[model samples]
Target: MPPSAGVDRAPRAAWQAALRGAVLAVACLASTLAAAEGQPGTSIATSVASRPAPAQAAAQPAAIAQRIMVLERQGRARPQETAAEVDAEITRVAPFSAAHRELLTVQGLMLAEAADGAAAERSALALDDWHLHPGAQEAGLAAGAALLIRATFAAHGGHDLKRADALVQEALGRLPPEVSDLDRYRFVMVHGYIKDRAGQLEEAVRLHHQALALADQLGTPWRRAEARTALAYSYFGARQLERARQLSDEALALASEATDWVGLGRAHNTAGIVLDGLGDQDGQRFHFEQAIACAVRAGSKRDEARYLANMADFYLKKGEFRTALLHAQRALPLARELRDPDSELVALANIGFAHISMQHLPLGKRFVAQAIAIDEDRGALAGAASTWLELGGYLEQAGDLRGAVAAYHKHRKLMAGVLRADEQKAILAMQEQYDAEQRNRSLALPQREQQIKAEQLHRRDLQQLLWALAGGVSLLSFGVIVALLRRVRQANRLLSASNQVLRQHGERDPLTGLANRRAFQDEMKRRAADGMLCGTVYLIDVDHFKQINDHHGHAVGDAVLVEVAQRLRATLREDDLIVRWGGEEFLVLVQAMAGDHVDALAGRMLAALEGTPVAVQSRQVAVTASIGFATFPIGPASLPVPWERAVNLVDTAMYLAKAHGRNRAYGVRLRQAANDESLQAITGALEAAAQDGRVALTLLRTEGQAKPVEVAA
Candidate 1:
């Protein structure tokens, strides 16, 4: 029934709390310690300035040190009194002493476990008082240990990859070569981790393999598990789900064998994500449950927060909005407690996304805005980029056009920066590869020198022997060299010609000899990014083209399509751009247009195809086309969107034209004033027509009227 006795009888989290309370009660009361002297935590001073009895100094520290290590093992839920005791012992313990060094490491780890990265950094900084030189036995070990703690804190607690990498590299440089393989494994793991976080997955996999090799060399099961998990994460990012799952299973098995709950939790979480990607709901759920359970058992608040965030994302992906919100809400407090901006960003973004997906626009926007603020403050570029994109979609769907536009702009800006950073990383990788090659070449220089020396010594004899045979072989060698040079030139010429053809093929369709879809999209994307090219897009379909293909065979059908492309191109203005959108379709953009000219142009396009019969295989074939068009800046009051929307609208109109009797145009007019309701109505109509193929199906049975339908202005 006694407090101390109850500690051992309690279970799990309860046992942990009981142990803390019992230890604190004993330390707070001097009489209890006096009654049971030399008990665990009995010798630890309650105040930093308090010194132990000289006779007790030797014995007391040993007991306090052992107790502190026990608390360190128990996780980060220790009471304030327990920390005070450790601090008091820190001051009383001799500087650079074994007890002091051990306490520093434990304190540093404890701060990290609390998700207090800044405090952890400060704890590690206290090691400077030792004044030990780098690579010195105890001093080097202590410094390396501090840096490892600091790196881990930076990585998980703050998501400060740059800081983490620096700390790890510093440790690697300072630690002696004879340092334990376990320490080396930890030191090497940071590079892969940062690369993975930064979206450099291939580089991360390579580094993780290096870490795995070191882990294997050390025969450390836990680190081997961690390295495998890290590699699996990169594979998951690359969407190689089966491989990711296999590696994750291996990692989980190793972690379980080592009783490494943290590793087990991370591996399970990764497995869940991979399973979700594979659409294995039962497998996903199992891993998700296991992950959460392991996170709780591991007692790492940072890991717990991350697991909650991952679950939120999982539910969000599944369209389970309320469940996502619940997990995200639980994560937010822990993220704030940890002061981890990245975690906060994920939690807030998920909450916003769930709300927005559930139609709570205002509430969702507020949460997303808060997340953006944190990301901006922390310089978390990837997080900011993704959140901005989500906000853009949310705002656009909510009909907040201006806000949506602004969010999209921000998203594009961040994406551009991310792309540039990724490109830089790729360039760096290439440079490193080249530098390694150059170094190898430099390494071979000495061997070349030795070879040259041996050759020079034999040169006199060799020159005499060569003089004997030179005259007879000279003509043959010369002829062979000339022949080889000519062959090399011929091959280079052929390769150049081949590459030229390939480049041409990339830009144009071989059959139609028209600009391909990739070329069109590239041009449109460039214009969109530059805030240029706002006009009208015409989507055209040859009426009953499939029937023509079935009746005339594909050869004649291909010829008819080519004729269609030619006729359409002949009618377009020099400034307009046209592309073979797909089979039996053509998309034209009126690059620069005069006021209300697009309507007339559409009419002319329909008339042009009807005016001429295509001559295919020396036979005239009757052909008529239906054209549908949509203009940018949906109405006078609105703004232009990316070319995609314009293309989709036109495509819908084209189908409707095909349905309501071929050879007519249906279009949405520009420069006509319209309210927001009209735009929404048009969008709704397009969506309905698209979803059920109602326009393409029903309108074909319409009354004899062949008039084109007017779209929203």
Candidate 2:
């Protein structure tokens, strides 16, 4: 993207539109009022009102236009106007002139109250179609204004880092090099802010450093503190909590000196997050409150909403469901009011988590489901993964084991893709930096060679040349150190690969390279933490495995287990983490599917393992396996030993399958007590129901009749 197309472009457009409207109104009024009072058309109100009664209304536009023209003059007289007055006047003239519309809208936004950013944003967007030619002052000003307004809007917009970045870049490009030094640093700081949002942490750090350097040169404390706050944001995102808090403290002290409410609010919020991470709940809460107060005093709704969401999350983490719910509810309307989708997502998710923790399953599901739906629509893969984990856990808690498993599987798949995408971006960024450095080095090669030749000629004497050789040897030794550093980096890359493999093993079965019970526990823990979507878990057991080992040789039994592992791995998605629980038992964690799919899963495993013979004592022996599966959130009653109970339930179902006929699959069911016989009967019934889709989705009755809702494509 070009510099002109960077972050903050949208807000600039709004300000431009508002400004044009103001200019038009001022010009028309000035001319008409001047005529009415028989005075030169200098002031807006007098020139417009002074026109003939029949022509007065018609002269309004003309007078406003004339005022704008005069204002553009080099020596025109004018009274000062507050930022608020300037904003109101700009809004008045927002409707006229397509060419300068965007620029005027942006100019108007520069003076708008931060609280009214949403409305101002709408005005800016209205000028999206306005374009300017190259080197046009009007165009450049509009772009710059749009960028500034956008950056301000984004500070509180939650998850819109992409849009924020584009606007900032656009604004920076439009800025003329001849502009005041302070203004230049302002643009640089905004750019740093955008980089922070974009998850380009190191880049944001570099940009902030640049901004701070400029501020130091200009001796501007105001801009310098702003840069410090921006740096803190970047550090926080990078998980450098200590550094972020330190920078935030520095920013806070400076903000107090300057009496800058916006800066102070940001500093407080940053400090609050770091404190929260450090387990200083009281300190975090206090800072959050302070942030909210400062934001409210500054009339900054965006900041207020942000702190509200932060407070809600803190409460949720503290197990204060009611308080968390209250804060989340408080933030929701404000988020909507600001038209910020990101804040909306966080508030809604927080509220949903509170409800879930409170045991309000249905209500909690609704809220979390809504968040997932919104995130999915926006193509936010990471958000969707988090929501899936939460929902899956809820379903498992509700006795829908199959549904939970499916949900977990979906979450894993999406999260893997997200991680890969981030890795790719990092790699690309590294390549770009390397390429740039190489080009710079290549460009300077000739000059460097010339300098070396001149030095060589100056040292013509043997003794002088000998001294020069000694200096050259020293430089060569330094070069060797640099080369060693490069080799160390290369070794680190190899170490990283080994570490990745080791990490993967921790989540997989040692014997079969399948997933382990610990992995399942870890996933369940994550789901519980996220507190979203309901899910189901499946505990499956191979029938009469001990008998098989007793009857057959241990080697043959081992072969059977290995074969089963291969089939399970081949049948499931890469996202589905499969693990051997123990002995003949295995667990499959899936997401987004229902209990009905469990039968299909069983059938696939059976078919994949079928007709494979094991050699025992030089003879071929075929072994048949019976599968017992149990689902949660779909059973008659909730099982407290959710994960473990799922396994036992499935074990009973497998026994039932063995009794009915060997090598068949059966589903597990809920029981009043640990009655193995009763569990088997229920499992058989559930398995039968699975065939008719009764376990997957049943038609619901609305008022006395079955109701149907068609899904929109």
Candidate 3:
């Protein structure tokens, strides 16, 4: 992926996309604006802007340097306009003094970061070289600023920690030991990013904290907000979601107070990601919109596209296929406009998935294939892994079981690499915790030892008077210590057990205490990996479940679902996997559907609940369910049937049951004929699924006359 493609790549929070370039730009704006209010910043522009100008920039090389620095900061805050402005300024400047050249070099870095390396080669200055400039203290400070910028490009764009480390070294070396608080803060922020990219997340987080403290020392709210945002980004990369969210909230408050739109947009982006993880779909969308609005106000096209992609993800989760496609399609052109391949890949992915949801198989598959190809070509292992997973989903939905299997295999392999990378981050987190505990223990140990010595000294007199009594007391103290150790061990054991239980419950339905759809899918994959080729999947839906909720309230509806799940479990074999698929729906998976097995099983499912009424709120609520089941592979040979298609088949059959009458069961065989496997046939079926309008009319009899009722596809 590109330097800033994390949010666009998907909200696992890689600190890319809206986070990196946008954040850097916003930081520049915030710091400069704060300096306008007499708060200090590392920028030569801020220093000059706070004081006086030195004649014409042409007359004084120092004045030219300051003007260049001011233009550089402005470029970040307004990339659309200032990119060309900075380019012209750099070109117009005749001879390069060390300080003047530093501004030009930093401008190149800002461009590269913003455009994801599109502007890296445009610099006349030696971007690769980091050396001290001969002049006053301000000249050294200029070199430090340039080093930080180059280091940013190296770390984020090139992923070259070695080069970045050298740049940072020069940055630190160039600065005097008594560096300005603002300069030191900027230096620390660059180092923190280097540490983060190197997978030293703990060190990275600490460096960000140091930056925050320096920001505070400057007595600027904007600087404080920038520090909080940087820390939040680090936490996000480390997957410390709660801490990330808290820091983002704090940063947002600061940004809002300052009316810093660029900073606020970045904060909103962070908040949106956290909200997505927490499953607050509405809140996530709201923040995503705010981010886009801020991005537009900040005159940042890249940010606009990034947030649009994120909004597509939000709509995808909501099952609004058309809306998701619209957002993704909108983002694709913007990404292309910037020539950002990584963001383009993600936009393609979003569009493909939306197409799949809309059941446009062939069209969706093409976009997915393109995205995957890009990932493979770019050596984007993480992006490739996620793209393959999306491909697997598309293939499965299209009933191409063989293709889906291949995609899944590729996904699993690439995903292992992704997980391995995270292992280092996990270890760092654990080590940090262990070190903290050791520090606490070390602090207490000295005090404890002193108290023990004092007690022994006091007991010397008692020991002389009564040796046996002293021995008895010593034994009692030892006994108490042993008991305390045992209790501590027991408490640790209980905590471990509790964590284990929490993990297990994470996949189960909270209301029904049954396996959820997620758990069911996992079990299906496990069974497939074990070479279990044949099974039956039953899709059961409660008839008029909404009416039940509307009449009896959601509390009663939930209670009824729990009862229904229990009844379904009672009817199924112990080996069968019963999943609370969704509201008022359950899925049952069992091995084999030979002979009359499917009919018998479906009958048992319907009878399970129809046999008795559910007791809810002291009222006997009538319960009836529609059942649909499908056989895997269609039983001609041993060819595997796609699980997604099997689910869809059963869903349609369930719809048929509803069309006929409530409280009935239906079954379907997987389409096994050669013609059914063709693209044309699949397209037709998918088209029908997409145009799910009620074409057939069902007769509803009331007393004597029969009223026509619509039946959906």
Candidate 4:
């Protein structure tokens, strides 16, 4: 196949090779455990045993290390080919000793692939092995490498922090007095990524700033871009949206200069996510696509999968079910092939969601259940919370209202717990840093007293006067307190209103004003539960929406969406719900409707959308909607075997309508209750008559007219 035709698939090969190399290198290191056991306490060990160096010296590497330091200084510095590549090459030249080799192997893997889990484990083992043979000679480079790798692992996996801290401490213990300024900066840069991921955001920001300063000193484009990117990511995770966007853009510009496609993709994706939070759907989608394009250029499957899933969800929210399903289908097989459980789980959940929008309730329900099961088995708390939220929607639609409520509440509780735990960890780290600072201040107070005493006295005097006011201040204090309380109450009210708005927004397509994919799933769940009663699910699509997007600008396409949503709303009853399952797809769930009633509803909806004039860019555009409907209790044959299966039937029917011609409604029916009753009666009469009237007879009829029924003989 041509590369352009298989753009998404090409990256899979490169990503697989990288991961394989990482896995094999790690395995090789792990297998070398016995060899690592006998190394005489080497260079790093001896350095730590001597009295620990001064604070400044402990913070930097020796000047003699300048040769190696130059290579390690920047993330993107050129052979003189990026700082990371230089660092890898430098490792080969400076020291091939056992301790350095262990460090090199770990650093090599990290520089080669930052997110490889197995490589991280191997690095940890190597570090542990070095500690086992600690001596004076092992202090500088070897010790620093150990600390850097351990921190990297912890940050990636959200693993043990105590071990990370200990390793960092050991590295600091061995920093030589004459170490180069450049080398120390690189060490800090490496440390920053780990700290950021470990939830130490403030520290992460500080370290990244230091890295930026060093990158400036080195004049390394790669280092600057990486530092900027890291800063952006850290800011985003910390909820500093504006700052993240600013840094991300800078990073992308620098990455462009270097042809760093992977970095560019990461920057775009990260920025896109922030834009999404800011309620810019078009901007988000555009950036997401840019990221996907870059990832493909870079030949990165993992990145591509990430982008595809993101884009799929975006389309799903836009009420384009067909497009969303296509992306989900594409992502699932890749996720499975890659053996990425997290990706696979997300893909499964997305697939289930698409099915639900099509009114294949049974099949949709099964898919969601499988996703939930996967999350639970893996002990993925966030995944579990997400699954629970989805399950709640299903139960709610299934008419298990109580179960739905419980599930929603459970999801809330889990999310709250995760947030609280993160907060607690942050607080603890801050407290420790504060305490350490206080201790440093106390120890330095006497030495600095003469120079700072006057400044301190002035501040103290100012504070004393502020505390000296009396009765006259009482009224003012009271008034101030009352005003503050009012402000607090106002803020609380605003927050509550905001949350409610968010919840409502969650169900709406931003561009179209149509119900989103989430709403469709919720509606489907409701209809499936009404299987015992009267409810019907309809799958609807905008005929040729892709061609529309291609010909018209997305902005105009959005206007068409808004117009269609308006038409749908007007045509549907107040009791019914219409969902934008994604892009050009819509789902309609109508209650108190029999098979024919649903078909009529679908036909009316199709006519309504087709008849409406969509004004976009001052032009009137004519479009049509295709609809398919499936009803429940459809009997043994037509009824969905599972809740999600119903979604499939409606989807299949909708496509059939589209296939027949545009702007039409296609519907599938369940067997009638009347037919079932007649069949039952006939069977009973035949049995009774054959038994020679041995069975008792009962006359049950409307308006006192007799309708004979026979009991068992």
Candidate 5:
């Protein structure tokens, strides 16, 4: 059997290699444990010696606190063992004592770290109960640390990002001004991790930098290693692979020097990811192996499961399906044991991909569906979208066209929701920017008025002075007044021009030079007021746009968008309203065209984009769009649909085109009068509605296809 064989039949050489790697990891863990035994707050023997003879019972609680602190510093590799120790200590201490509360806090942190959410929640509740009791000490660093742990777990689990973010904020507020640098560093790192998970990469990087600075002040190799690893993870998220590699390398070296087993494991894992991104497959594998070894030595089932899953993903990508399945199978049980849904998701996905590649279609699809179910339950929209796309590709490869199309549709729908949320955020940001500019203008107006008054008074004083003086002085003062007047007039003209420019910029997307959503809103409002809202709405989305940006660069992506905008302009009628809807989406409003003309226009738009490759950066890159279109007053009875609802219908249709395949168009039209219930049903389930004869749909493909369209009416 190969090194990647099943758990029971693992190769002897691989075992020996793993054991060799574990030597250093074990030494590091031992050194950390030894150091913990001598720390001021963690020395049980010292604590016991300090207590008076008659107060020996009181000393036992203090001793237990010291022991718990020691176990905490010893690393999280053996959370179960550490937890057992905590449980034993709890029995030794008086119930509800200060020491007992400290033990409860550690227990909560341990459970959360291990991904036991239910038990951790219970522990958090207990802590809350204790805090509410009379004469209980103010919730301090320990409570804050526990909350941070829970917040991190929540964010990583994809359970509730908003709640996790709120919890972190609360935890930060709870931290005392006099908290130690180490404690503050941990809190900052956790906060950064949460922010990164929340898609705030820049903020996460900034927070990680703050943590690094604090670690530098503390001047400990272990802390510095941890900080660098965290910052490296943020850089990885930002897709700065080279910078991440550099930081991860530095972190690894620092951790090795400090004999920090836990930090070493994390650095190794981060390095593996960066290496994989950089296409260093051998380096990636080695790092993952070392990470697993370190995790094993540290007694951390959670880390072990994660590293194994990552290894499985690497093998799966390399086309070693059986090897990948074996690794994933091993990881799945460990993840389940730790109750880590996130790691379980990774394992299941890898296993599914592997099985599908090996021709186990039904079994693979079931596993993939299970993973997606978990993602949906956890509200992990991005994860679900990616998984659906992957499944679609596999289905397509397996010649299951119908299944592939269905999977793609689900992927497109989820991705559309994600994009919509992102668009909303962008709109809010633009609104904020506009509001800020308005505030600046408001503040400047008073100052400008005051300056104008001051200038006028100075002019009057100068005129009086000139009158008091001679003819030459009067002429010079007149010249000065005239020059000042001209300058003021120039300033006013410049200000007006600036305001006009701001308005134009606000209404247009800078990248594509097309009217933006704000302009679209204004046009819609105008149409509504005039009672002339009877246009065909088309929603066009650039296909695989993010991939283009990632593979090429954002600069190239912008060029593509610019080219797309120009192509759209060339394809549509001059009277059509073209707007940069948001992101890689565009909206077009064609003034009341004939029904047949609308369909023809949709086909023309698709041809215009797919006909020629876009010329950008001296390279011809193929660009295509998925288009969805609908004409207003669409039914046989000519029932009017609101412009908003009409646009949404077209948006759904566009996704349908995307689901079917890119470089195509899908248009929706009502065959009968659309009541509210029927419209809702159609919008909610377009394909199903089409199948059941609730609406008519037209799918337009590129020129080379066998048929121009397949109309379901």
Candidate 6:
């Protein structure tokens, strides 16, 4: 049902790791120290002991802050040593002091790095006490950093994203105005990452751009590399492969020049994802290998695990199941040792898929069940849904039809539940926004009412004082009339604006921002009224879209649709009308053109989609569309065809294209002059009409083939 289940395709879990692995490397911003300054081997105890008692007393907090920064950098490689050092520092510092809070912040970051979520949350809550004594210097900054650590871990663990977003916002708000650019950059990157995970690609891109700007301002190559890598990942999620590749390459160069191993590892991983989407299997393999090398050189077990899983996925996709199994086995221990559930899950899923590919059915199903259990424990519905689908594919491949059907049904049910939950979240968001607006209006109402009363009192006073002055009274009356007219006009403007907003919302497909059926119907009606309904209509449907949703999850499916809409806009003329005609289908209306030109345009549309694979969630998915087109003003008699009938004809042709192996276009044209009777006969059965020579059909394919078919009635 989904292309032999799992042999050739990269598992969704591996793609997710590729897309998010860099987030671990960049989460702390302390890694930038290696490039900005020097190695982080300076001992805090020695530095403090060397200072005189008086100087130590004055600069103790600053020294502790520096040590915390160094530990953050070291914690990536030597987490246990760093944790011990942090504990010693915390023991020496005064409880709840600025230095103590800073140590607590670093502790939380380490705990999060180790994937100890409960511990991290406890640390975050402990840090929240800083809010009670907000007057302390640097209290907000320490608390904010801890909150961010918790937020990042939650987001990556596939926990509550909404809560994670709120945490990020809270952290941003808590940041002091005088914080360093590096601090702000970390916050922005984390914010962008959270937004990206939440399916807000445009917003995520904007935030990443802001981080890049901050990096440029900071003048650090490592910072720039991290920002570019992050931005590249965002672009990859949006299916802009070329842009992602360029950015990832730049990040690689910058990281290499700066000797920033963490940055280099992330850059290589990002480049691998882009190369995979570009269909350069060799290039992706090389990059993934380089990513693992960089991670090992950096001594970051967390990063090593992620990169190893990615490499295993690559080998799995290439049909090297044993190689994949070995790599996944290696990654699994590292993930479990780090207590990193995200990496652990990826490793488990890859192992499962590899085992299944190797004909170890029972073992594979056991591993898959473990992965699913992890997802359920974390309440990751999206992950669970895709895993269920993958299980279904495995069952189908094993020839267990009944088991496959049941698994598929479970997958569908889980996905439907996920979609409904997302809808409820969206509705809740809208309600909150509406409530906020209402509160603002309520707050302004009293002020407005007071101003109105003041104006009326002033007018009454002026009328009484000017009772004997006729000219003054007349001027007051005119002023009142002008005010009334202004108020009426203002109300009208507000009404018009509200109506415009409503119209736009009603007529647009929210997912792709394309015109919907209502807008298309309105356009058709307008065109008919203007007697200008002469154009070619094309109906395009994405091939195997349901399978994509089943294999990749709904989020990636939505990304595919959005990318397709963008590609359509890029390929078609600006004046052409594009609409989201139906689920996984698009309709385009081009200005009247000859049959040959229409065929050429249809070919362009097919090539636009099938030319390259779309990148989504760090995986490459090949997408193609089946299109059917027809130019109106039928037969040699120039019979005016109604828009509805024209649409029906093109729909038929679209189905024919689907029937003919897809990735192609079919065009319908009248063969000769036909009366109403013949037109009805032709419309009743399009293929029959073509077979009888009542119509001529043209076929164009992306494989560079074109032909005309006709028969005598």
Candidate 2 per-residue C-alpha lDDT over 1-713 given as tens digits, one digit per residue, 9 for 90 to 100: 00000011111111111111111134554566467434565444322233345444555455444444333210001112323333344544434342245324433343232334655565565444345444443445555766666665554333456566667777778765666554566566656655654555667777787777886786534445566766766665555668878887887887677565655776677777556544466887898889778767755555566677777766765667899899889988987986655556677877877787787867976887777777788677776886776566545555556655555555655654665535644654554454334333343244644554453444344344445555677665666555545554554555455446445644555457776655665676686654222344444556555345434433456666777787778888888767787667777767636545755665566555554665655656565666655555434554334443345445544543444444555554343443434433443344443444334222111223223211110
Query: Please, what are the lDDT tens digits per residue for candidate 6 over residues 273-343?
Result: 77766667788889889988987887777788878888887786677889989998998999898777766
* Better candidate by lDDT, 3 or 4: 3
Instruction: Give one digit per residue, the lDDT tens place, for model 4 in 37-127.
Output: 2223332222323322354343233322332322232221111123234343334332434335433533533433334466555554554
lDDT of each: 0.61, 0.54, 0.62, 0.54, 0.69, 0.70
Candidate 5, residue 379: how far the Cα is off, in Å? 6.5
The superposed Cα distance between candidate 2 and the true structure at residue 405, in angstroms, equals 3.4
Model 4 stretches with alpha carbons more than 4 Å out:
1-118, 127-138, 158-191, 194-200, 237-239, 390-403, 409-713
**Candidate 5: stretches off by over 4 Å:** 1-75, 83-107, 122-150, 176-178, 239-242, 272-297, 315-320, 375-389, 408-535, 541-597, 608-623, 637-648, 658-661, 691-693, 704-710
Per-residue CA lDDT of candidate 3, range 1-713, in tens? 12123343434222342223222344665475444444456443233334333333334454444455455444544554555655545443433445445545556555656644545444523433334433333555555666666777676556566688788888788776677675577678778767766665666788888998997887656557767877887776555767888998998998777666666777888788766554455777898899889878866666677778888876765668899899899989987897656567778888888887787877887887787787777666766777775566556655666556566556655654554435634644554454443333343244644554454554454334344544566655666655545554554555456445544654676679898755665686787874333588888889877456535544567778989988987888788898887767888889886736666677767777888899876889998887766676653454465565456556655644554455776565423343325412332242233234211212222213223233332
TM of each candidate vs. truth: 0.52, 0.46, 0.52, 0.46, 0.71, 0.61
Question: Which window of 10 residues has the lowest lDDT sum in candidate 6?
Answer: 1-10
Kindly list the per-residue Cα lDDT of model 5 for residues 1-713, writing each as its tens digit: 11112111111101111100111343444455334443333322233334334545544544454455555545256655666666666665556666666677666665665556776677677666655666665356556756876785575443566688889999888877787665677677767766665556666778889999998997867768778887887787666778988999999998898776766887888887666556566887898899888778766666777778777766766678899899889889997987767677777877887888888988988898888887788777867877887777666666666777788678767865765645655755655555444434443255654565565666566556545544455456567756656665665565566556556755777678899877787787788874335888899999877556544554567788999999999988787899998778999998878877988888888888888998876878888999999888777877677665577678778867766667888888787787755675677578877887878898887767434455662
| RMSD of each candidate relative to the true structure | 15.3, 19.5, 13.0, 16.9, 8.8, 12.9
**How many residue pairs clash per model?**
0, 97, 2, 49, 4, 0
Off by over 4 Å in 6: 1-52, 55-66, 78-80, 90-101, 131-135, 176-178, 394-401, 416-713
Comparing 1 with 6 on lDDT, the higher-scoring candidate is 6
lDDT of model 6, residue 352: 84
Q: Which candidate tops TM-score?
A: 5
The candidate with the higher TM-score, 3 or 4, is: 3
Clashing pairs in 5: 77-298, 77-299, 77-300, 78-299
- lDDT (C-alpha) at residue 712 in model 3: 36
